[model samples]
Target: MTLTQDQRSLLTAIAQPWIDTSEWPLWANVQHQFDMRGQDADAIFHSLPRVGNEVSFASGYGYAAPMRAPIDPGHMVRLTVAGVSKLPRMRIAVGEPFMHTLRHMIDLYTRRPILVDEVPKTILRSGELTAALPKLDPWFVKVLPDLLSYEPAINTGGGAHLSDGSWEREVTRSVMQFRGMHTVEEYIEKTCEIVTKNAAQTAPFTIEEEQPMPTEPERAPYVDLALLDDLQKAAANTHWKVHKLIALCQGLNDAYKAGNPYVCAAMIRAVMDHIPPVFGHKDFKVVANQHTFMTQRTDKIHALKLVDFKDISDDGMHRQIGSSVPVLTMDNIPQPIRLNAMLQELLTILRKEAAIAP
Candidate 1:
């Protein structure tokens, strides 16, 4: 009953009669529903099958070239039961699960699976349930003098298969006719029952397969992960505004491993220019000369001045000359450990500044 816009869109599209198997209209419907660009939908629709226990796609039919998860809308595509279970998580008009209220209720009230008797109390307190009730059990004109006009799950006879593979044997709403449909209480209980499994499981490959398994080649980190992680955490907290200092430090490390000495030097100089504000200095040279933090770290300070690295960065950036042996190499850059220590100290000062603020 409760569904996200995407979930609603999914349900609405599928609930329509199977007579319209036209591919472009269905795909166009998907595009209009999601409100994304055409270029992105090409990749996004193809990828939905990759989402576990949610959206799925049909496979190619012919014998010549078999494929999995083909998005040809003419072929039937169905929702998995985990997708149905998530209906309770959606709040009527709101697209997000605020607290997953039913799950929270279950977690609080029962150590075991909820009984049909326990459902009424659980349903009344649920904000999503209340909002969804009116839409689901909407007042309708009498079709005849005796029969009541009613529709459950928006009148879709479409079935959602359980990700656990139990739907094949289970007597669920999917198999039930309109006359034998579940009551609201039974519906709630069964919704909880059918969706109790973890959805992360995937099918294992067998020896019968002909193609080699796809393997992604792993590359070692281009930077010290520890330093990168620390900077990334800091950057995450301060992301309301741009953080060029963090970006430069990350680029510096990446350039170091990639063996681009000119880039390393430029990044080093950029960090020196950019990071002085943390130390309350106008420039790195001034920070080196005046700031207590820089003065205290004797080795890093000495390395900055003695190596003439900043000037080399400027000359390479400004001068145009023949590249006989090139202007810079890894030897010209400051020691990685030394640079890391300096960045660590900058983070230390920034944290202290943040802590002391009112």
Candidate 2:
């Protein structure tokens, strides 16, 4: 399959969160439990399938000693399932949503009375699967191996002594570390509001000098030969179309400006590289303002920026891990200094690339 460089970059970026903390056993067990109960495990896996469909289909299994809360024993269990395709696969760790689906399905299935003990309080925890499965196993199956169920090691006051307590401690209610997720509206309105307000309040007090718009014969927007050929086929009157091309270029610029200014500048440079002759003094000015706007309205800029790339440091500072420097602090630096630094860096790269002989 063909993919552009940026498209490939985006695909990898999108998949990284799932790839980082992949746990297969928990996902397999959850799938198996649902599968035994006539639930279509394949359907769930297919719903939000991985970038390559084959990645989700590869399967393997192993046995695991029973584990306590926070440690999923199921993830460690040994098992194997057949894949539909013979292609290689990428394994992903089971995420919270997968666990929730299993928990909810179990709750629905166990509404009727089939046991004496209260539905395992471990299951009640809504997060602990290890303790709850033991409770469910005794009632549902026979000759269940002791290894299938896990009991917590009891702490007997002092530092050295410990008790192997199967039922000594009572299961406390499971406190979900991550509760409900917020809707897009709630997050955008609340988080972005604070970000926007802070940016406006903390913006640098740079003087706005009104410069006259340039009057020298504005360069006619140029279209690539290949694209021009395509346009000629579509339009009945394929004149030089200077005005239309100019308007189209303006439209693209406007679209970029309407979004985060940093993004606008980035897109402007990107388009300029592929579509030649549009790169001029005015284009540079437009791109420059975008940098200034982003730097001045940093809170909004950071908020709009993707989480992973949000915290770019000032050029003078070495890149430090987990540094939370304020975006608009103007100590020893000129107005929008950080923005200017980044803009210069971007422009330098572009100019360097343009100078290279093809």
Candidate 3:
């Protein structure tokens, strides 16, 4: 698929720095660019495979899993000029050929297309790749200007610039530096480290608040149990069901205070489960489970909107995993808090509808 104009712009912006420094652009480089532009790094990073389909050099590009040993760095694999259609067939560690070919391409100053037969058996070794650099340098230099002149019309309004003296000067400087480099291996390694460090330093951009999956929401002040002592005392003369609800509310409030949010969440579900049965609505009795009871009957019978009850129940249940469990996090204080507020509202409705004292 073809890249959109925005995608192309993003790709060019990301690739230019690496090209200018004569380095192979990695996924981290793309991530860094997105971070700088305040775009979603992860979304843009995943989109590369589609964007890469348009670029000849980007075939087979993918992230390499981190090495088993902690000291080794995780990097990306990409098809360079040397690996174009052959790297996938070769037996080597991921990212090896891509890195080696990138070093060779920059050192030799050319992406000389070669047949599979021409590819060396031991291309991973720096010494073997270095031997072929001189032969490729002339071709690399010849095509250098065209490669660096990427998206010339992007900034130059649709028309191409007839003469850009600054572009020529920059290319000349880069060529001179390329010639002055002594060891291809050292240059590649240094550049790789520099790029990795720079990429690491870039923080992922924060998505706008208007977007979904908001971390926090505007909340009402927490209603402490101590402040609700009057309500609890008032329930003494009320029906047994009302007394049971008051006790559940007390337990829910106590769970929150004790920092057992999972317990609080469970208490919320418990209250919902108990309250529906107290009404004895025909629809509530017909439902197979509490999930259906809360979602359907409670809304119909009490005019209480438990539209998000299923989601709340699911989130609460998942949060009840043991401390050792790593499947889901246990930090769900808001779930119970939200449910407590809903329960409070439900209690107020019951007090008025049932005409209970106080």
lDDT of each: 0.40, 0.29, 0.38
Candidates in order, TM-scores: namely: 0.36, 0.16, 0.26
Candidate order by lDDT, decreasing, is: 1, 3, 2
Candidate achieving the largest lDDT = 1
Runs in model 1 deviating more than 4 A are 1-223, 232-242, 294-303, 323-326
Q: Write the per-residue lDDT of candidate 2 for residues 44-133, one digit (tens) a residue.
A: 333322221121111101111212234342233211111111112211222222233334334533453456866543222222333455
Q: For residues 13-35, could you state the per-residue lDDT of candidate 1 as single tens digits?
A: 43232113211134445545455
Clashing pairs in 3: 108-137, 109-140, 110-140
Displacement of the residue 63 alpha carbon in candidate 1, Å: 44
Kindly list the per-residue Cα lDDT of model 3 for residues 96-159, writing each as its tens digit: 3333444443444343345677742111222333355444343333223323322111011111
TM-score of candidate 3 on Cα atoms, chains taken together? 0.26
lDDT of 2: 0.29
Ranking by TM-score: 1, 3, 2
